[model samples]
Target chain A: MIVIENVSLSHRDTPILRDIDLSLPRGGITALVGPNGAGKSSLFSLIARLQPLQKGRITVDDMPVDTTPSRTLAQRLAILRQDGAVANRLTVREIVGFGRFPHHRGRPAAEDLALVDAALSEFDLHSLADRFIDTLSGGQRQRAIVAMTFCQGTDYLLLDEPLNNLDMFHARQLMRCLRTIADERQRTAIIVLHDINQAASYADRIVALRDGRVIADGTPDDVLTEDHLESIFGYRMKVEHMNGKPFVLHHL
Target chain B: MPDRRMIVLAAIALIAVLLFLTVGLRGNVQFVLQLRALKLLALLQVAISIAVSTVLFQTVTANRILTPSIMGLDALYLFGQTALIFALGGFGYASLDAGTKFGAEVLLMIALAGALLWPLIRTRMDMNLMLLMGVTLGLLFRSLSQLLSRLLDPNAFAIVQTASFANFNMLRADLTILGTIITLAAVVVSWRARHVLDIVGLGREAAIGLGVSWIRTAAGLLLLVAILVAVSTALVGPVVFFGLLVAALAERVMRTQRHALLLPAAALIAIIILVGGQTLLQHGLGGASTLGVVIEFVGGLVFLALLFHESRK
Candidate 1:
């Protein structure tokens, strides 16, 4: 479980996130949906300790985010941001192997190597495993990075805008991968997503934010409505149901 | 393939060592050999120091184009010498023990490096901003050094000239020993932390997410860079772009991001450049110019080529 209490972040006198009180239970996918500048990334940054908290307490499971040693926090949680520039001249397999750093420090055991192999297969990257990251396409590189985060084997995973630059086919493939992993591995994942339909389809719960504040939070059926989304996004969108799931159509 | 490259580099470095030691010998065979050996040791130490320092600095900054010397370190070294000369005069400064002076310069460089670089790296500011600040500070230090140097007498000025420029002929045995010990220690630390450095090259966010304490690792590596740069500068006065030349060559030739291979490869390349270039300058050029001139010429060209290549990309 992750609990965020009285969290407020301000930069240069401009509040980025204000009084963001929320709790996320363990073992499910939570899609964080918000319009641009809605503090979605900021919230992920806070949870991952990428940015220091100014006014509040956050705890993952029982460990306080602020007080826990970085290694301890890393072993329990992993974060992949929107625009991460990887080291050049490294192959996909090598990059994924870095996720096991917290566990092995500098020396990798046999088990660590096995896990890296598993992550590569899990992401369907066997053919591209030996390819250099810089040589891979945007979608392929995204999958490799996601595979790295998953290889960390943390119970809690936070990904910010992981779908950026991906084509439709790759995006669907990635979302399906995340959904299956969260369910089968019994891991909790908080993903910041821009495509409402993707979130609506794969997210067990959807949390909506607008202007650094949470406007709505619940199951997709309860929160992803035309009225709620219009208020949150400052525009109207069509919400349709299919197979007991709500889908948002913002493009039309 | 990397192992093959390493072997080739090692062979080249060894051949250069042999040429440096025995290519030409005149009267007083023992004395000449001893002198050449001292110079060789000094060159090797400087090579190791600059190569390792530059590679590590690039890793932390995540910019292959930058070297530790860009952060006003060499300028500060020049400033230290000029300040000492101005306060104590030529004779007084020259009369001071060399060991004590070397110790003071190393300490001061470390202090200056920490003051100039720590906060920027710790706060994780824009790398371009950090680079700009470094360049500006370098200019300021150079200006200050020039101001003090102009006030000195001719004899003092000559002394400063010898210390200000890279001179392989002025190598000292005691200082070479000290530098060797310090450089060896840095090499060990870097080797031990090769895996950590690999992650560090991934940039700060990912490194932190991987649980490698980003701030601490960067700070430690920067400190190591300071030590390595200080030792090299103290031995061979500010070979400004040599680090860039060797580090770039190592990265280009090895084509590997792993520091364990990269560090040694860079070191070997540096040895080849310094010792081989020194041999050519002595034998081919007949000591018409210092090795520093040749290095600066070649290294400056490499730097420009790299800039051009990066721009095209």
Candidate 2:
């Protein structure tokens, strides 16, 4: 579980997040969706402790983020930041293996290697495992990064803008991968998503923010209404229910 | 492949050592051998200290072209040397024990390095901007040293002048033991933290996400780099491009970014270059040239080649 209370952040006296209070329970995926400048990424950074907490307290699984040992927090929560620039010289396998660093520190035992291999296969990355990350395409590299995040063996995964460089096909593939990880492992993932349709398709719940404030929160269908979408995005978008799932024709 | 390359480098370094010792044997062989051995140890210490320092600095900054010298470390070292002479007159400096001076300088550099670099590291500034800042800081250090140097007595200024150039023949045996201890401790610490260095290459957020306390780790490595740079500079003056030279070559030789391989490989490469160059100058080539000039020449070319290649890519 992740709990955030009265968290506010500012840069150069310009408020970025204003008094955000949220409590998330375990075992499902939560999608944070909003347009640019909506503080989606900023809020995700705070949960992952990428940025320091400015005003209030945040806890991951009852351990306060500010005080928790990074190594201890790393075992419970893993984050893939938005601008994740990987070391180019490292092979995909080596990169994925680093996910176990918090657990093993540096020495990888048999169990750690086995888990890395499993993550590679789960992400369909076995063939590219030996390839250098710089040689891979952007989408392939993104998958490798996601695979590494999964290999962390943490309960809570925070991925900010994981679909940035992915094409349509790879984007959906990644979403399906997230769904499997959440459903099968009962892992709780909070992803910052720009594509509302992807969020509608995969998210168990949707939290909408506008200008650093949480404007709407509920199941996809409940919070992704035409009125709610207009308020959050400042524009109207068509919402279609296909197989009891809300699909937003956001491009229209 | 990495193991094979490392073995080849070790072999070459061994040959360089043997050549440096045996190239000119005459006149009381035992006495000459002991002197050569001492010189060999000093050279090795310099090589290892520079190689390890450069690698650590590059890793913490996540940059390929950066060396501690570029970050104003050795410049600050030179500044420290000049300042010491200015504060303590030439007679006082000449009277001070070499080990005490080296120890004091190392402490001072470490403290100053932390003060100047901690904010930039903590703020997570862009590496290039930091590079620009470092270059600017280095200029400041160089200029201040120059200004202080101008005010010194001619005799005191000569002492400052001696600290600025690279000279291999005048190895201070008194300072060699202190430098070797610090260099060895740094090497061991760096070797133990090799895996962490690899993660550090993944940049700030990812390493922090991987459980690295980025600020603490970077600060520690920076402190270590400061120590090695100080030892190297204080021992044998400032060798600007030697660290950059050996480190870049070591990366190419090993063909991987793994510090476990890069650290040893870089140090060995430094031995091969420094020892090999000194031997060639002292024996192979008529004793007409300085090893420092030859190294700076070749190292400058390597730096340019790297920049050109990076631009092409």
Candidate 3:
């Protein structure tokens, strides 16, 4: 379980995240849904230790993020930021292979290679494994980066907007990939999502944030109601139930 | 086992060395060979130090276009030269022990480099800010040097001009021992951290995600790069574009950024360029100090081409 207590963050005198307290249990997908400037990415970055935590304490399975050795934390949790880039010419396989760096530390044994190969196939990246990341399409590159984060073989995956640049088909496929990891591998993934329907379909729990605070948190049916949607997104959307799932007609 | 590309680069580098040593065989074979050998050693030191430092720097900055020379380190060294000549009259300056002057100059460069670069690394300053700072600092140093040059009496000015000049063909061996020691140490440390350097090539957040103490690690590498640029620039004056040229060429030829391959490829490429260029200048071109100009020309072209290529992409 990941625990956050009274976390508040301000950037240049403007509050980015307010006094936030929450506990995320192990396993399944927990989706963070919010509008722009809602501090979703900021919260995600603090949890991943990408940014320094201000006025808060966060622990991942009883290990404090601030004090734990980077390698230790990396072994337990991996994060994929939205703005991932590769400056040099690197093949998708090579980039994914670096996911096992904590284990091999530059000397990759056969087991590490096997894990990398498994991750490639897991993400349906077998055909594009050897392709250069710069040459890949945006969706393909996104998948490749996701594959790398998954290959870290960690129990906790924190992804900030992993679905950006992905079309409908690829976005659904990527969410399904996350679902498989959560169900079969018994991993926990906290993903920042903008597509309400995608979060409703895949996430076991939905968290709604607005104005730098969590306003609603519960099962998809509980937090994604019409009124809740209006309060969160500043627009009323019809939430229709189809096949025991909430179909939010946000586009309509 | 060395990669095949590395093998080819090594072979070419070796051939360049042989040509440099044997091209103008004359006089007492022993004396002439010894003289060429010292020059060869000096050039090799400059080549290795500049190439390794530049590669490490570009990785930390997360760009192919920014070399350590971009940090105004070379300009700073030149300013130190002018400052030294200003304080001590030409005769006093030339009369001082070369070893002391070189030592003082290197120390001053490292001191300023620490001041300028350390905080930027610690705070994770934006790349654009760092670049702006570097350009602004470089301009200030260059202007200061020119101002000092203008203020000197005609005799002292002539002395400073001759003293501050970077002559590739006639390098003194006074500081060769110390420079070699520093360069070798930097290379070894750089090689030891080769794998970590690869991880750092992944941007800050990615590297931190992958278990690197991003700030401390990048800062350490930046210091190493500073020491390297200091040693080389102090020995041969500033060769701004040489490092950028070699590093970019190495990446293109090797086709990857894995430091295990990239570091050696860059050093080898630098050796080929410097030693080969020196050999050509002495034997083929009647020994002009135009090697520096030629490097600036080629390196500037490489820089522009890289920008164009990136923009097109």
- Predictions in order: chain A TM-score: 0.97, 0.97, 0.97
lDDT values, one for every candidate: 0.88, 0.86, 0.86
DockQ, cand. 2: 0.78
Which parts of model 1 are misplaced by more than 4 Å?
Answer: B117-132, B297-313
What DockQ do the predictions score, one after another? Answer: 0.85, 0.78, 0.81
Per-residue lDDT tens digits for candidate 2, residues A60-134, read 989998789888999999999876888777889999999999999889999999999999998789999999898
Q: Rank the candidates by lDDT, best first.
A: 1, 3, 2
What's the C-alpha lDDT at position B229 in model 2?
Answer: 81
| Docking outcome class, model 3 | high
TM-score of each: 0.95, 0.93, 0.95
Chain B, per-candidate TM-score: 0.90, 0.86, 0.89
Give lDDT for model 2.
0.86
Clash counts for the predictions, in order: 0, 0, 0
Which should have the higher TM-score, number 1 or number 2? 1
State which candidate, 1 or 3, has the greater lDDT: 1
- Superior by lDDT: candidate 2 or candidate 3: 3
Off by over 4 Å in 3: B121-131, B163-165, B169-174, B297-313
